[model samples]
Target: MTPTSSLKLTWSSALESGDRATDVQHKYLIEIINELAEAIETGKAGQSIRKILNLLKQYTDWHFCREELCMERRQCPAAAANKEAHKHFMRTFDAFAEEYKVSGGSEDIAMRMYKTLTDWLVMHIQKIDTNLASCPDNGCSR
Candidate 1:
């Protein structure tokens, strides 16, 4: 794999979910992903990669909780599906984390993480998260 410094993953505006807070979170995730890519490329990741992975794990869980709360509050029709998707993503993430621990941030693990954070995350924000924007009050109601 190419050096992490050589790789650049920028956040595209097209990934926005139309909710300011959600959008901010998504952008931060993109930033973290870029950091991970850089770490991998520079061969400096080591335990740093584990920290990033832990950050990702925590952030995703927190974000999913917020999203699910929004979905529930809005009485969104997609709530069930959204919850399922969140569960699935958490499971996938846990498995990846385990693999990373076993592999020690190998190139393959880096590639997998890059894909998950960039491609999968963008798709989820654009497709699934965007649905929340359709709700009244932008799904922020208590």
Candidate 2:
């Protein structure tokens, strides 16, 4: 797909960190990202943006809970740091959502949301969630 296809936000196998649960969560994140992109492409940006934001909020919570559980199970030392990162993501997401709403849900706001989410997810998965996949139970390292 072209970079603008919205599929650009997809979670590729390359992004996998060897943890089945984490990979699945990342896939869900990609799905939501694509959904928002599709919504924008189809000119349903307003409704789709809201839906995507809500889905993101829910998914973020679920993903973090699972990551924390995995960390506790494996006694991963980075769990605290990961949780803190999740909190930061939540704060940023909330701020963006509020701004989008306050801006009257314009197309420009939708575009901004699309870019922000896609960029953030890509960076976050590569940097943060992937690390969790390296934990003992994740089969990435000793």
Candidate 3:
């Protein structure tokens, strides 16, 4: 698939959590991931994918930290579960990164990373992060 075609697979409103800050950050992260996907789909140079991978690693780590902090501040009921989820994601991502390195610039590696990230992000935001918005005032409805 071409880059333009890949761009069509973008972040949708279904992922929104009704939290402005989190939504904005999530959108940005999705955009970055999409850029990486597009680069890989379009057969861009290895440098392109490498750059994006580095950016993704950095942004995801930073975002996870911020989200965890927000969960703590808001006393989110699902905070513990959410943190555990983040840890799992980080581990998975690290493993993928290692595979990408070992693949030696193979597009297959990039493709795998793209699929994993897209699936993981969509599920995490919709099912997990959405729960945080409900505790806006640090009080769990449940």
Candidate 4:
């Protein structure tokens, strides 16, 4: 890819969900995204796209499951919508993964995939995850 501009996203308070575990997971997700961007800018993504994307998909699935269960247990209002959003994301990501597998992941496809993933994650955190901050205990702890 080797774009002139940076594609990394900063992890700040603005990205936090006011829950320790969730915030930690979110931070890790940001780190992965940043790593992908670095690889892309170095023209190294083609070699590691499968590993990176698989890791991302696995982590995202785990994270979404934990978040959804917490929300449901805590009776957070965003539970259903969040679950739906997660499903939609998985479908989109799965399609991308399949396409990448078939095409060997071109730089343009990787760049677009990265951008799409980053944008969806940031928006999902800001709009949906922030609601976790108010889920009764404010921590979703058992």
- Please provide TM-scores, in order, for all candidate models, with all chains considered together: 0.84, 0.83, 0.87, 0.92
lDDT of 2 by residue, 1-142 (tens): 2356734574466677557767877787877777778888888887668877888889888877887777767667777777887788788788888998898788778778678767777876677666755567744223
Task: Pick the winner on lDDT between candidates 2 and 3.
Answer: 3
Q: Model 3, residue 39: displacement in angstroms?
A: 0.7
For each of the candidates, the C-alpha root-mean-square deviation to the true structure, in angstroms, is: 3.7, 3.3, 4.0, 3.3
Worst 10 residues of 4 by lDDT: 1-10
Q: After superposition, how far is residue 131 of candidate 4 from its true place, in Å?
A: 0.5
TM for candidate 1 is: 0.84
Predict model 2's lDDT versus the native.
Answer: 0.74
Candidate 3: tens digits of C-alpha lDDT, residues 79-108 = 898899999999999898888788777887
lDDT of each: 0.74, 0.74, 0.78, 0.85
Model 4 over residues 1-142: C-alpha lDDT tens digits? 2333568888767777757888888888887777788889999888988889989999999999998988887788999999999999999999988988899879888888899999999999999988977777745654
**Clash totals for all candidate models:** 2, 0, 0, 0
Cα lDDT over the full model 4? 0.85
lDDT of 4 at 88: 99
By the lDDT metric, which is better: model 2 or model 4? 4
Most accurate candidate by lDDT: 4
Name the regions of candidate 4 deviating beyond 4 angstroms. 1-5
